[model samples]
Target: MIRVLIVEDEPLIAEAHRTYVQRVTGFVPVGIAHSGRAAMRAVADAAAYGTPIDLVLMDLGLPDTSGLEVAAALTGVTPSPDVIAITSARDVAMVRTAVAHGVVLYLLKPFTFAAFRDKLDHYREFRASLPSNNDTTVSQHEIDRALSALRTTDLRASTPKGVAPQTLDEISRAVRAAPEGVTAADTATNVGVSRITAWRYLEKLAEDGLVTRRSDYGRAGRPKTRYLWKTKHAN
Candidate 1:
């Protein structure tokens, strides 16, 4: 689960945001902070307990310092979590300021679920593809592809890897054979390959809007990510 800290001053808005986060498949609403100062305390407490907050859903107009100021403060600390500014502030200057402070995505308020889900799915893909190597270097093509993936909002338009399209068919066959929802590990077993290879194919399906991923809750050491065929995509 992506542990999230929501910073919103209004009780109703905070609750609404919390509910939305809970409704998502992979997000977990760890706590709510009604003010910038309260946000700091909650994050500090979580960090002290070793359950580091993975992300912050910040609202710019906070009771304390501006949300940008709160983000700036938290980001200067060790192991800063990713910040995505979720606020009604739409002025270009404020958006620029949020981006200047390293906010990944600045979401304007009053969006429908479809628009919100699309942005979130892009973020999920981007996070999943983050570099694991110590070297910060990458090829131009890799950078271009990664950035393009983030800007893409249409699920019908996502491109899969350069591998043969037959891989998709093979995946469908393998998953269809199983009565239960399949994990990448399961696909890897069926295809005689490593789990990481399996994950790439499954993620491609997710990108193509053929599959939906959900956290496998209950009876597990770690939350295993599972993929279920979206009903509309099944043949």
Candidate 2:
């Protein structure tokens, strides 16, 4: 399992991340740090336990110091956990720096669970293929496929070894097949991905003008937002 540390200050967002971690197959949240100082403590404890943290889902907007600064400090460790920026900020310069600091992924905020899970699953695949049998030299073809497939925006070739094409089909079918409209949470459950991944797709659909958002009402609790596929136009 990949041990993940979350360094987000917002309670709701942090809880959402924790929920996503629980839902994924091979991810475990080691701890949460609300501040950079607190983040150091959390990392120290996890490292002291010997497992350390395999990855960190960090928010760029931190209350204490810049998220990049925190990442810089963390990456200075002997064996740094791959940092995945999970923030709403889309500053290009900051992102460039993040890439330089060894961040494997950058996920924009307000994403669907499906998108988030897709990225994590790819990361898992990439890590799993690293010298599983170290006695022999790794083949170039194997290394190429591993790197190509791990990209969040890229799709793995059609095979049972990777995510099947039917998964995306199922998600589209689930939403288009809905009698009315599907909530982000429901779409994720139906697609077998996380809500964040599902939401990311929904956002893409929204941007493309394929799906229109309508506030779902008449339910007790938080009002559900439904993404209805546009019949007249494609998003």
lDDT of each: 0.75, 0.75
Best by TM-score: 2
Q: What's the residue-level lDDT of 27 in candidate 1? A: 84
TM-score of candidate 1 versus the correct structure, residues matched by position: 0.61
Backbone clash tally for model 1? 0
Q: Write the per-residue lDDT of candidate 1 for residues 1-235, one digit (tens) a residue.
A: 7898999999998898888887666788999999999998888888888887878989989987899988988876555677888888878898889988878777779865544555565566566555745367877866765565466334333444464445555675465446476899999888876898788888887866767788987685888888886533422
What ranges in model 2 sit over 4 Å off?
132-143, 154-235
For every model shown, what is its TM-score relative to the native structure? 0.61, 0.63
Model 2 vs. true fold: TM:
0.63
